[model samples]
Target: MKCITRSLSCLILATVASVAVACSGADGADGAMGLPGADGEAGVKGDPGAAGENGDKGDPGTAAATEGTLTGTVTDAVLKDPLADVTVTVKDSGGATLGTPVKTGADGKFSVKAPVGTVVLKLTKTYYTDSADIMVGVIAGTTVSIAATMSEAATGAPTVTLAWTGDDFGYGKTATLTATASSPTGSTLTYAWANNTATKIGSVAAGTDPKTATATLPTLADATKLRTEGGVETQYVSAYKLPDRLEVLSIVPDTRGAVSVGVTVTDGRGQKATASASLNAASIQTGLRNVALGQRVYLNSGHDGTNAWTLTTKPAGSTATGRGGICSPPPRGGEYVRGGRESRRDSRGRSSAT
Candidate 1:
């Protein structure tokens, strides 16, 4: 019996050892990974940080004034009275209009703003002549004042028209200058004539009729030449060596030039209107010389016995002597006794043929 118990105990112990060995085996491969969990909720936000310090101050700015002012007055030229409601249109040098037009006040005063440059003012109004292209200058940030004038309209003034009788009139021809003038009130018009030339080539005379005048165009014998400072006729010599009694010197040439006839017609009211006409006067005769004062001239050798000639301011001096036959030598040299007739001194200090 004791031997059978011992065998059973050994078998039990062996089975237990086998069970422990299976339990202590090496680690097996890891199992598959599980799915991830969901995310958590966010927390409350914190307050914002404080602002940073300010930067340094900047530099000062510059002024801006790119315009100026213009003020002026408009007045009537004849009456010297202030003109109201005058339209002032400003323009640049290139005729470009600047800004809107300004009207004058009752005191003829006006003010306007303009750019920094030159500008022109064009003034206009009813019953008055239009005064245009008046120049003015403006400066930046400054005011410029000026005064302007305009003439009265010619509504009631006399109107005159002038014309010549013939276009064939020339140097040696007589020109009939006729002026047709009329006043609004039909007043008798008295005409005054003038020769508008540096040299007075002919005589200007008013006709017996009030509207008619005559200008005897210069002939070769009538035109006289004189020296001028700059071809201008401003010097006048004394006719009788008296103060303030001067006469114009002649300066007619032997070439092409124009002479104008101006006529002023005065109405009964003394309001005068003027009209002028230009006539071209040219000498056809060539080689003719002026024999007047300060002129060196010679007489033609082809003179007939019936010809009478008067010499003035001979080449010798300012005085002249009249001779019948031929020109004698000047008094500085002895006179030439011509025609074999005796020559004797007359009572008037003149040489005559005996």
Candidate 2:
């Protein structure tokens, strides 16, 4: 029995040692779990660290855009009063209207903003005669001022009357021609003298006062030629100067069965008027006959004779008489004698031909 007891004790001791080794292996397995606990604390929070330095300055942002303006005024021409509600337009030199129309303010001021370039400005109104144009340069952030003056529209057609100081003129003589003109409203008077060549001398100031101009009677060389030679009547002496006076005989007949005539019968610087009848046909014929008798007739000789004349007898055997004469002298002596010899005999037979 003692031997059996001792064997049992030895078996127990071996069992215990084996158990202790197993327990050690179990603890080794639990060591990985202890590492998980340490990791938990480490994840709980990181240690606080030093602050970082400021980051490099960011790149500059894109630059902002810039901007501009145009400004101006409108006024009346004569009164210089501010004009409101006038349409102001901007344009280019090419005449194209640009942007929008701006109406003037109560103070007649206007302004506009545009890009940098050359621009044309125009101001217009219905009551104004016409529009006006202005040139300007548009720049960024700049205000351009364009001023304009408007003129009043014309109401009606202006009347113009012309009168001369003297109607009768001598060849190659210069006369101070005083032209008196009148108009209801002030008129811009223009002077013109009509001939074969129409010529405009000049224009005078706008007013009711008369305007004067001086023109010289052209020389014969300067006179307008009307006839084609062949002993034709080259020119008619419409104005004449007597020994002591000047006269303008009308080309038409008067109510007194005589030619209407105007005779300035006074001497130099004197005033005179006459209402007597002009030369009758018979008197004209008589005067023509006397002139044919070779009486010397003095005329303004300054003309180059472009308007001069000399009388010549009719060609022999020519049926031409008064109306048919190829070439005939001007009527003289203020008498009209018909039927050559018969009229002459009648004049000599009667004491008074009238």
Give one digit per residue, the lDDT tens place, for model 1 in 106-206: 99999988888899889988756799688888899999998999875565468899987654254466778788888774557778889865566666788
Q: What TM-score, computed on C-alpha atoms, does each candidate reach?
A: 0.30, 0.28
What is the Å distance of residue 316 in model 1 from its true position? 42
Question: Which regions of candidate 1 are displaced past 4 Å?
Answer: 1-153, 221-257, 283-354
What is candidate 2's lDDT per residue for 212-289, written digit by digit as tens?
A: 333444433233223334563343222221111122222222211122222122211122222221222111221123
Identify the leading candidate in terms of TM-score. Answer: 1
Reference-based lDDT, residue 6, model 2: 98
Error of 1 at 33 (Å): 99
Top candidate on lDDT is 1
Cα lDDT, model 1, residue 205: 81
